[model samples]
Target: MKKFMNEAGSLAADSLDGFVGAHDDLVAFGQDRKHVRRRVLSPGKVAIIAGGGAGHEPMHVGFIGKGMLDAACTGHVFTSPTPDQILGAIRETDNGAGVLLIVKNYDGDLMNFEMAAEMAVSDGGHRIETLIVNDDIAVERTARGTGRRGVAGTLVVEKIVGAAAEAGLDLFSLKAVGESAIAATRTMGVALKGATVPQTTRETFVLGETEMEVGVGIHGEPGRSRQDIADAATIASLICRQILDDLEPAQGQRILLFVNGLGATPPSELYLMFGLARRFFEAHGLVVCRKLVGTYATSLDMAGMSITVTLLDDASLGLWDAPVHSAALHW
Candidate 1:
């Protein structure tokens, strides 16, 4: 419940103002600050826009820059951006080449983006396509029948697709690239501690000091299971096994391994987890060609991390290596 801000009601907005100011050279706000957009866009290039809730810092917003999303529509903490907000982004970012929306597989996100895309096409006559990322291997179907929730694998999708878009790929071609990346990606997360939503001033979930939740969602949603806390090696083994079994990458397959901290985890621990995860992958006969480790996608101050594996081919590999300059990711 302890946070520095003007007020709980304005936490999301306040934080955004500071972020926009800090990275103004790279990004700017759309009308009414509905979205964060790249300061300079490559005219006629496919515009890549990704968005979702607000608490996952350096995600949709932090990723707005060269070789990545041209714009990002952000909502209140853990809330979906409204259709109007999304539509505005589409209108502003779309040049001749059209806009691609990268949305996570959450009910609110899916519905709102769909509404906006429909509006943009029907009203604005803008060509817009949507790519839904469902790489979280933790859940095949929610109680409401929603498929796998998008987790840290979202970064993989955005980066690869962004690079392709920057390379002048058309709308459908970029969509194809995004779909291929999603198909090759799988992720799972574990929570050592729960996150506290500023508005409610309460932790999204409670965990005993000795308990941990496996396969947790970014929104602090219930995970696959809760169990007594175990050592890092045990935890890494359990998570890597689940990911490899599901992804089923062929032996010697090249892959990009990402270890994303969920807001509160420290770099030291994240790196340790990465080492353990790499061992697991190498032991299984996979080649770790590209690797990223950091606090990329996060739940508001949640102390945990997620592991993502994307089977990589030559085309995807080059796209990943392509130059990118964003608030959160650059190479």
Candidate 2:
């Protein structure tokens, strides 16, 4: 509602323009104008392209750079990119080694990307594969029986898979790595305040001053439950427990812990949550092999955060630590 923009329907496009300009060092707007690709790409390495809607910053777009996605097709806020846009991304990023698409498990995303992949392969004569990330432990099915909704774990998929693609892995191997990453990951989020889309003056959802959604999705979707806001420790415990229940982490098992801000949550709060998460890990006898804390994936100005735990193996560990140069994450 209280956003700075030129117009309502044009927010996504205008914001993308700013995004493209700011990350000019690493990204360029595709000819189709609905996607982004790395400035420099390997001639014959497996190219990785990840995309979804626009509000989740430092996600598909922010992860476009060295050792990551070669292209990212962005839709409007919380919407799926069209098949034509996705096809354009496939064509542009496909090197001699082919291309891989990392899409969340949302129905629209799945359908659109699949259609685009088919179009690219049968019509464009390009080889393209798709990896669907469904690591949200919040729920197994929504009202539409669309299976699990993808959340922050999608970022984990991009990181490990991107590294493998950069290492010249074949298309099949790269897809396997992505699937493995998704299998090893689980995420849960809580929203203290709802977000307002740029097109409307109303918030996506209403929350009482002292109430919160215990397990929120990135698109302002309804979470599992709503309750009075609790302390950081309690909130962190609930999120960790929900994800760990699904993950079933073993004693002394290693994990890559990520505490992500949902746009409006501050670093101070996220670090506090991370501290509590670490305490919980210590109490559970789990070892955190790597730590990533920030707003890597975010809703549109939503005051919340998500916790993602990826049980890392030797291969994932090495790839997770691999060098990455991107807009949102770099190491």
Candidate 3:
């Protein structure tokens, strides 16, 4: 309810315009400015396009730059972009080489992006392959009947896949890398409080000061349980354990540890949780080889965090360390 906007319904469009204005050197707006693409599209490069709702900033958009997404479709708050909008992005980026669609596993995103792919090919016969990210260990299915929710792990896939694209990998090989990244990554999150979408008058969900929702998805879908909040270490244990046990990688394996704040949680707290996660790995013989910590993915002003673990071999580790320059991440 309390948002700093002149109007409500136009949040996505208005915010995207402001973003283009602020980071014009890094990204450019499509005809309507609703679609975002890299300022300079590489002709021979395999364009990586991704989209979803708008509440989660710096995702799908912030990652739009060199070594990340080539184009991103911005939708209304928690709503999928129309086929036409995605089609606009696809046409803007494709240049001889094919385009890869990196979609999160959600009903709206799945359906809309698929329709957009068909429209893109139908419009001009461009080749497009879509990869669905379903790395969340939160639940097998949500109310929308999608597979597992795609949470923070999607970022790693974007980075690795983007790096592969930049390495001049063909579309088919790039998609294989993306799928491998998705399979190797796992994510879990807990919400101490719910987010209030800019378009909505009420918070997405209500939580008591001393309560928490475990296994939360990015869009504030109901998690597996709502119970009294626990300490930071305890919280890290439960979430990290579930992720590690489910992954069950070989002992002494190296991995990337990404800890993300929902929206309002501070770096101090996120790092605290990150430290606890490292400790857990150390005690269990897993190596915390490379790590990215901060608010890479988030809900709108929600006070919580998610921890993502990606098992890394030489190939993924090299791609993970590949230089990246984007609004949210820069190296």
Each model's C-alpha lDDT?
A: 0.94, 0.89, 0.89
Q: Compute the lDDT for candidate 2.
A: 0.89
- Model 3, position 113, has a per-residue lDDT of 95
Clashing pairs in 3: none
State every prediction's TM-score relative to the real structure: 0.98, 0.97, 0.97
- Model 2 lDDT per residue over 198-297, tens place: 8776788999999999888999988999999999999999888888788898899999999999999999999999999988987898998899999989
Candidate 3 accuracy as TM-score:
0.97
Stretches of model 3 off by over 4 angstroms after superposition: 141-144
Candidate 2 Cα deviation (angstroms), residue 71:
0.6
| Worst ten in a row by lDDT for model 2 | 138-147
Q: What is candidate 3's local distance difference test score?
A: 0.89
- Per-prediction backbone clash count: 0, 0, 0
- lDDT by residue (1-331, candidate 1, tens digit) is 8878778778889889999999999999999999999998789898999999899998989989999899999899999999999999998899978999999999999999999999999998899889999999889755677789998999999999999998989999999999999999999999998999988889999999999999999999999999999999999999999999998889999999999999999999999999999999999999999999999999989999999999999999999999999999989
Better structure of 1 and 3 per TM-score? 1
Which regions of candidate 2 are displaced past 4 Å? 141-144
